[model samples]
Target: MSESVLKTLVIYTATLVIAVALASVLILIPAYVHYGEIHIPGSYNALYLSKYSPYKTIVVEIDYQPGMEPTPKTIEALQQQIEMYSGKEVLVYLDQDIEDDEVPAVIYGYDIIKITSMLQEQNRDYRTGWFGGNITLYILYLDTIWQQEDQDYSNRMHAASTKPYSVGVTYAADSIIIFKGSLPQNDMETTILLHELGHVWGFGHTNESSNIMNAEFEVYRNGPSPDDVVETWYPKDFSPAQKEELARLHETMHILALFN
Candidate 1:
């Protein structure tokens, strides 16, 4: 080959090698972190913390939106579900048009601050994307999780990833789950609730249809299906290494629970 042609080929080969190396690193970093072969703190990994900390306690504030009537069954179901996150304590407040109550169903600016302070004071760990924190709900805002006229229903619905984790603290005050008004007859409310709850417990979406952690809302029962337990990161499934992490986290949760 001519000198120019040989130089061009070498340059292209070098670029290809560099690109492959970067791609390999991108893929391996997560695998290495997940496998316990290497632990990368703060790097995102599929292995998540269990919702219920044997050591720590979590408190939640469920505020309802005005004109949004969730049945007692729904509230009870949510309370029961959250209890799984530490098996110790969870507090739920329900009301409308209040300012900064522990749980304000409706949007009062003061209520937001109150809830935020509670989370901070309690030192809860929350997620960063849609799956973390108490869902900061704005009822009837029309900008949030509401259907628009002429919009495709499938496209408009809330998916797990649609709302990335805004905050990542799990606390007596941090995670805000907001209930918008006029829950549709369909399984929207239940699905969203369960999906968000899945996030709270450190479970990521999976391909299993029977699991609540699936990203899509094909099955929206009031609570977790039997399948959810199989993959949950509770004390039952912890490997030796994961068990250590659980012990440390739970011990911290227990300290917080004393104040609650």
Candidate 2:
């Protein structure tokens, strides 16, 4: 080939490669922005809960055994924390005087599968359908002597629904269980509650201690010591990434609801 022709071909090839790369990035950016690495379960295809509506509300029903109920202040703190992180209205109701007949069997060793199955059996009669623009969550506070093998009495056990149930069927309670004995200090109760609620909203344990979603309940921070200190911390709010994930889930649910 002539020298001039070769140079022209090389220039055209470079320009074409750059144009293709730019087009691919433009196509991927919107998907990344909207989804942000969230994976919705297949079962959620039929489930729809709106988190954006002005009337969107989450009703939390607290069923506590004798001497295991959370204090009014603690409940207030939980409500405020959830609202602050999610930007949604939360209504907490104390279901006083829960009888033994209504309480589920307590399983030991932090066995979430067993605990959730028992809750499903106990709350079989409860309705589980979308309430227009609102969502309902149940919480059980029990003093039934629950224990985790690795955790001490000071460490609370908190569990929530890990997956969505069938449409129009309430198989399990979307619940958080707080054992009274686990919460030794009144101040720490709110942090525990927030952590459990984070699970309900599809957040997993994070290594970052500064985040309330951390399973270890400690964050690393600079201190008077030369090295970074592993200080005990309780976040009053969710991390920005956590908040973004929750928002993405809500938006997905809202869009899915339209088709159902």
Candidate 3:
């Protein structure tokens, strides 16, 4: 082979080797160091911590329907739950109530897809992406009566995490919509909020029902009552595995914040 051709081949081989090594590092680092779970929709792994730093405070913004504002007790319960799991300062902010005319357009049914789409349309600012510390969450409380269309579904789904975590690209503008009439006694509302927040922070559903990330929820129905009160059982707290995952995420966020 000519000298120039041989030199060109060597250079191409070296470049291929370097590219493969770099790709491997990117894929393996998360597996070893644990940078949170990869979201299904976006396939990104990192959870975006607010620019305010989790060590200081994580703000939760609530946008409720008229007269459906979460009670102070519910706020306290949510704060306590977040502090317990994340070991971060919890700050709750009540944003203005969603306009009456916009409520119908925002909530089409109990389906999370439709709700998220409507929310994105009406409030483009709330779309998932990197954002500052003004808000880490945007929860919407639907005061209307609604039910899951699935007949076989046992537990009444109180709320859902509309947006998945996207690494570096998506912020924590994760949304949760709760039906006011569906809440049962106990801190059920708080439970649902924490569960959805877990999803926003890159936690997936668990098989263990006692864990806060449990996939199955037990529905509680009032047998004889004029109001027909109903709610789902709330897990007491996060499992050990979940806490470990969250700790890893916090550490990763701290390291990334340092560079930023």
Off by over 4 Å in 2: 1-55, 84-89, 100-106, 109-126, 131-134, 148-173, 218-232, 250-260
Q: What's each prediction's TM-score?
A: 0.37, 0.54, 0.57
**Ranking of all predicted structures according to TM-score, beginning with the best and ending with the worst:** 3, 2, 1
lDDT values, one for every candidate: 0.37, 0.52, 0.51
Model 1 misplacement above 4 A: 1-57, 98-143, 146-173, 176-183, 186-188, 218-260
- Write one digit per residue (lDDT tens) for candidate 3, span 1-260: 99999999999999999988986566553342232221131122233432323224556667766777777877887777666645556667785557656655222233545554565457534322222232244567755534334333233233332221111112232555565544555466666666666766666668876787665442434333324434345675677787776666655543232121
Instruction: Give lDDT for model 2.
Output: 0.52
**Model 1 RMSD vs true structure:** 15.6
The most accurate candidate by TM-score is 3
For residues 52-86, could you state the per-residue lDDT of candidate 1 as single tens digits? 32212333434333445455665666666545434
**26-119: candidate 2 lDDT, tens digit per residue:** 6543343223212222222112123543335666677667677788777887777656545567777776545565544444453644654565
List candidate 3 segments past 4 Å from native: 6-59, 77-92, 104-112, 124-135, 150-173, 202-209, 214-218, 222-234, 251-260
